[model samples]
Target: MGFWHTMVEVFPRFMPVLLEGAVIAVEVAAGALVVALAGGLVLALATLAPLRPVRFAARAYIEIIRGTPALTQLFIIYFGLADIGLGLPPLAAAIVGLGGNGAAYLAEVYRAGIAAIHRGQREAALSLGLVPTDVMRYVILPQATRIMVPPFCNFAIQLLLATSLVSAVAAPEIMFRARNLVMETYLSPHVYLLAAMLYLAVSIPMSHLTARLEQRLKRSR
Candidate 1:
């Protein structure tokens, strides 16, 4: 009863400020997604390169990024880089760090999707005089996109939630604003609960969309 009373008192005051932060969170997620998609695609192609050294380097990057904690990566981008005069703004650092981390994961997703397409399709494309790039662009990726869509959506949701980590770097996303509110109001429980709700508001829809995509994919299969 006491908690409910406090929540009622805080709700109106807290919501508007938190919504402003949510906008920034969405922006960060979108920026990071763009970076992840581009980097992941490049890394995926590199991993599949004919040269052993190229494949080895790409795999090493994927492994190293995947092996480290994301917070450390953010710190490196936001703080560590500053020591060498390569400081990025908090928002940029957040996007780059998260996107870089996400790329390693998404590269595997891209590889799996590409591999799921039959080798016969690639051979047929080649037999039609298509170069490797066109074979990938016209034949392989068109089919692989379907296989990748659901996982991509899933990863987007994960990335959205992971934006909370950026608060450590003072990027002023949802959790960062929530922490500030808690500090000012000394209402940790109420503020943090509202923050969680804000994240859910975005994440729930994304999760639903991912589920729908998976269902559609299964039906098509």
Candidate 2:
């Protein structure tokens, strides 16, 4: 049978599972994104910290996470943590792992973004009587965030795709459901093809939206 025929034959049975997985996928991505942003910001600030020890620790974490494979991180979170009697749900473990990993990458992005700003901008903000926090909030971060948007959006999409690895820990995300369908129907191409399409559906729009938002921000400035 053709791929379309296979889709028709399989979808009715699989759609429910696929839909559930999609929900899980969105939930995981959104949760991870939030964690990544919060953690990344803290790490970014630490990167500029005055204390040597704090700066060293932050940089070390970023390097370690960026250097390691996310799958290994997931295993450490899911399995290794269980060894210590800190048992988290598989889905929670996946979120923490993915979010923590993404945070490291994003912290570097934030660091670079902040660094790209002209030193004059910081001096000027200080001269204007703004406190350090006020300077970052009003001057430095506002512009740096604009510069960071494109790369950050790309990482967000990567995070979305990375959620697939959660399946290894029994998180029932889209790829996990796809694997189950493939096992039952033995229709690898169609099952995976549909999964890819669904991912593209989400990712493509997000990319475009980010682009449009960047443009709008530029115009407003």
Give the best candidate by lDDT: 1
lDDT (10s digit) by residue, model 1, range 65-136:
999999999999999999999999999999999999999999999999999999999999999999999999
lDDT (tens digit, per residue) of candidate 2 on 1-221 = 58798788877777777878989989999899989998999999998999999999999999999999999999999999899999789889988999999999899899999999999999998998999999998999999998898788888888998999999999999999999989988988888888888888888998898889778877976
lDDT of 1 at 210: 86
Give the poorly placed runs of model 1, Cα more than 4 Å off. none
TM-score list, all predictions: 0.97, 0.92
